[model samples]
Target: MSVLRRVGMTLGLPVILLAAWWFASAGSTSFFFPPLSEILDSLVEEWFGPRLAADVWPSLYRLAAGYALAVVVSLALGVLIGTSRTVRALTEPVFEFFRAIPPPVLVPIFILLFGLGDGMKIVVIAFGCMWPILLNTVEGVRAVDEVLSDTGRVYGLRGWSRLRRLVLPSASPQIFAGLRQGLSVAIILMVISELFAAENGLGYAVVQAQRSFAIPETWAGMLMLGLLGFLLSLLFRLVESRQLAWYHGLRRAQRSS
Candidate 1:
């Protein structure tokens, strides 16, 4: 498709939905269905005004910290489990059982252990993000070509060098896919945990606004969360595109052929 056509296709649904929402709710008198214009005003005044610093930024910080921790731990354990049949066999069942237990179900336990602080919420978010990443990394690493390992050995690439030069590059595409999944999961947990345990976050702000019958502000808080999630996903894709440019180039060549 032409660039302009692709852009239109991408934007089409969201634009249509937004337009539909605008017109359908334009004359809304229902408190629950405030007009989009009023909602936008609340978003600007409530969120962009001071809630940006008080609620939004704190939530972003928690998300960043939790997700970053998840990435590091997932990659480390994933590499170990992926590269070793013994480790994978030992851990797979346990990991599977844990992953099956929904993260929210464990929220109370986490709160009990870590208290209703950032620590509890961050840990919850990290746990929520870990499973997909761990599984994907294991899949990626195990799929790395044996020939590449042999080639690395022949060239005297040992231990960390072998992993850095051969394993990571080969597994990166799947790893990044896992990272993207984990990112979304992280964001969900970030908000959900905030709703329950946090004193200050976008989620907390929304809860407060709703309890006070400030529907527009509630919508505004939700809108801020939506925007934050969108922007974070966009940033991840840009980074992924940059890092995987070579992989993308090869795919393009194959498609063209």
Candidate 2:
């Protein structure tokens, strides 16, 4: 019953939102805010039909490649810094400095350095995504119970084996949290990069549509972006649940106690 209620709530919320939007935009005067039915019709004809196949794939490809690269590099560096006090001390300040800067501000620099190409987009996404994962991994590693380390040491586990067997598993939940954050940031940067100067991707499509006063098509592109972000977040949550079930169970146990 609880599960069914949860499912209903999830599905019902979006429907209510759409209904509200339909009514609210029924008589909108703003060129940007077309009626919901017109937007939906445009979305179906463009986003779901032809424009989607043409533009969405390029954007999704960039997102996938850039995000995946960020995850791999960030996880490796994060684990290294997390395990090593000296490395953390040496790099943390630099990491914090770069992380503090808003990613959009770097677009011009990236464009200059790498040009308006896949390289530029990938690097921008990776830079934006790295900090969250790195910081979270550090926290996760730092938070591992000392007793577990002691147990591993007592069991003749050392170095890589200890990290793989003890630290990684214990830190998985926090690391996943960071990855989710990083992925979200990556998506934003990916769109921003394309929006400003690119010849491809959904962001470019949106800008083009807006400039041409194709308001309905512009809304359709925006809707596609929202859908993409939603889908990515949902995917991350599913992976997190599957991988961190034990961690969640432990958390529940501790809370109950």
Candidate 3:
């Protein structure tokens, strides 16, 4: 598809929804649901200046730190557990217990341990996001074909080389699936973490606005988060496409055959 067509297809629903919201809420007198135009104006006014640097950057920073931590730790632990049946068997029940708990519930515990600071928020986000990626990585590593493993061994693809060339490539699909899921979880946890005892962040800003009866500003903050999420997801898709280009091509060829 042409770039213009692709853009249209991508943005069509959102644009339509925005238009509907604009018209529907244009005459609204409700304090909670302000006019879309007013919300947009508030977004531009509040976010286009100092608040952007003060609130937005901090939130983004925490999100990146937490998500990066999750990805690294999960990949390492996942590989270790997946490659060794003994480790997997020992860890499965513990992993299952932790995974079964809702991440939000741990926020209070984390706050008590780490205090109400960026450390607490980041840890919360990382802990919440880790499970999906970790589980997926474990499954992917376990699914590697024995023939491929033997072939790699025969070719002297030992240690890091074996993992990089054989294990990682074969597991990339599931890892990416987990990464995608984890990204969403990370965003959610970032906000939720901030909602509790946070001085600055997108969630804190929104909650403050609502408490102060600045309905338009609250809506604006929400819109900002939604837009940020969409942009992040789009960026992830682009990166995923580039990284997995060969995998996608192979799949297409297989389907054709």
Candidate 4:
């Protein structure tokens, strides 16, 4: 199919489904599933309204802070362990044990330890985001071509110079793949933390709307969360495309060979 046709099909599917939903639920008055139009109206009112902006900012701030910390810490540790066999062996079991545990299970512990404030939420988000990044970084480092390492050594590049010039660039694509995975986890944990115990956030808004039986408002929050996730993933893909342009070019050349 043509690119424009493909794009039209993609956009048309959602529009069709939404139209069907709006029409199907037009006659219903149940709180379980509000009409699509009503939900859209509520979304516009809540998201575009001045008062709701306060709640949105706090949630975004916490998410950004938590995810940023996770990226820095996990990437640093992952690179360190990835480069050192001894360090990787020493930390493997502990990392596996923690990674196996579901993030939601730690919510109560975090709340107890850090209270019901922003600290607990940030920690939870970081905890959820770290594993994917760490594991991916390790894989990325391991996947670096042995020939590249030998070439670097022939040039007398060692230690930090080797890592900075050879290893990191080679590993960047896989590292980015892990980062994309971690971003989704971060968003999930962010909402879950807020849903469980938060005074202000999109998740809190959803809970409040549900409690009040405002079905349209609840749907609006859910839609907003989906949009947020989509936007974040798209942003990551744009960055990945630019950062890994050389990798893509190499792959294209290999395919033609």
Best-fitting candidate, scored by TM-score: 3
The best-first sequence of candidates by TM-score reads 3, 1, 2, 4
RMSD of each: 1.7, 1.7, 1.0, 2.1
Between prediction 3 and prediction 4, the one with superior lDDT is 3
Residues 19-59 of candidate 3 have per-residue lDDT tens digits of 99999999999877889999999999997677799899999
Residue 28 Cα positional deviation in candidate 4, in Å, after optimal superposition: 3.6
lDDT, each prediction: 0.91, 0.87, 0.95, 0.88
TM-score-best of 1 and 3: 3
> In model 1, which runs have C-alpha deviations exceeding 4 angstroms?
1-12
Write one digit per residue (lDDT tens) for candidate 1, span 152-214. 889999889889989999999999999999999999998889988578998888998999999
Candidate number that wins on TM-score, 2 or 4: 2
Question: Each model's TM-score, in the order given?
Answer: 0.95, 0.94, 0.97, 0.92
Clashing pairs in 1: none
Backbone clashes in candidate 3 total 0
Q: What lDDT, from 0 to 1, does candidate 1 have?
A: 0.91
In model 4, the runs with Cα more than 4 Å from the true position are 1-12
- Please report the candidate that would top lDDT against the real structure: 3
The better-scoring model by lDDT among 1 and 2 is: 1
> What is the TM-score (0 to 1) of candidate 2?
0.94
Q: Which sequence of candidate numbers ranks them by lDDT, best first?
A: 3, 1, 4, 2
